[model samples]
Target: MDLNSGAGSLDQFEGGDATVRGAAVVSTRLSQPTDEWFLEPLSEIRIGATEFSEPDQKLFSVTQFVTAAGRKFSVPYAVATRPARGRRLWRAKVPAAAASS
Candidate 1:
């Protein structure tokens, strides 16, 4: 997915599997997959010092899913880094606070 050129750019990945590099403002609810869990986009994201006008990348992470009723689950998945291009960066831990937010 091609991210928009604004703060909400990263937020666009709320329900999708993608990893966005650069200086990202990680979501408070990043570990959750529920409708209520949303990500706030970053003001700027870049590789090195070069701004990403349009980036194609991916991220890999082990994610944990929790049901509204309190059941929990985990899975490994790859998210597009720049949206529709690039390879995935791997992640291991999903913060508990992030999951419940």
Candidate 2:
């Protein structure tokens, strides 16, 4: 468990016994082995971003995820899910002002 050491060279182990040198942060034998990681297909995609008109200040309720790729869609806040990195995709109740966008 010498984590301070650099990464291990798994490439040295070709196809034979590759399962023994699999990836695991903890020390434990896996009942079910797997060589692939991305097993599930992505359901929804995060193409772009959305911004509401300041949520109408006192008129609107909570923030929401209602826009993507410049198109508006009604997705409840609770059930909304999107993967965005840094400032690429942002969701907010307020209109996408220069500060946020």
Candidate 3:
């Protein structure tokens, strides 16, 4: 998905497979949107949504990044809003060993 910078301009990324395989999740909280965060490579992203009284709604997109050294960073962005913010949505990650198969 292409992530744009701003407020309330996020494209709808909901209503599909619970988990988006090979998704590019972006982070809008950095000094600049870099490939490591914006162009998230080899990441499995999950999309979620919730309604909070009328027009107020929030959508979540979560992904984890693993570096060559094995460091992991779980990044979750509120994709419902432009300039996506970070919000934790309920989810569990299957261990790499178990997911390999």
Best by TM-score: 3
lDDT of 3 by residue, 48-90 (tens): 3222223535443444344323445543444444433333222
Candidate with more favorable, higher TM-score: 1 or 3: 3
Give the true-structure RMSD of model 3. Answer: 9.5
Model 1, span 1-101: residue lDDT tens: 32223422333444467754432222346476667654443332222111223254324332332333344332333342433322223223445998899
The residue pairs in collision within model 2 are 54-95
lDDT score of residue 21 within candidate 3: 37
Inter-residue clash pairs, candidate 3:
none
TM-score of each: 0.20, 0.16, 0.24
Q: Candidate 1 vs candidate 3: which has greater lDDT?
A: 3
* Better model by TM-score: candidate 2 vs candidate 3: 3
Error of 3 at 62 (Å): 13
Compute the lDDT for candidate 2. 0.28
Q: Of the pair 2 and 3, which is ahead by lDDT? A: 3
Which segments of candidate 3 are over 4 A away from where they belong? 3-20, 28-48, 53-96, 99-101
Q: How accurate is candidate 1 locally (lDDT)?
A: 0.35
Give me the runs in candidate 2 sitting further than 4 Å from their true place.
1-6, 27-101
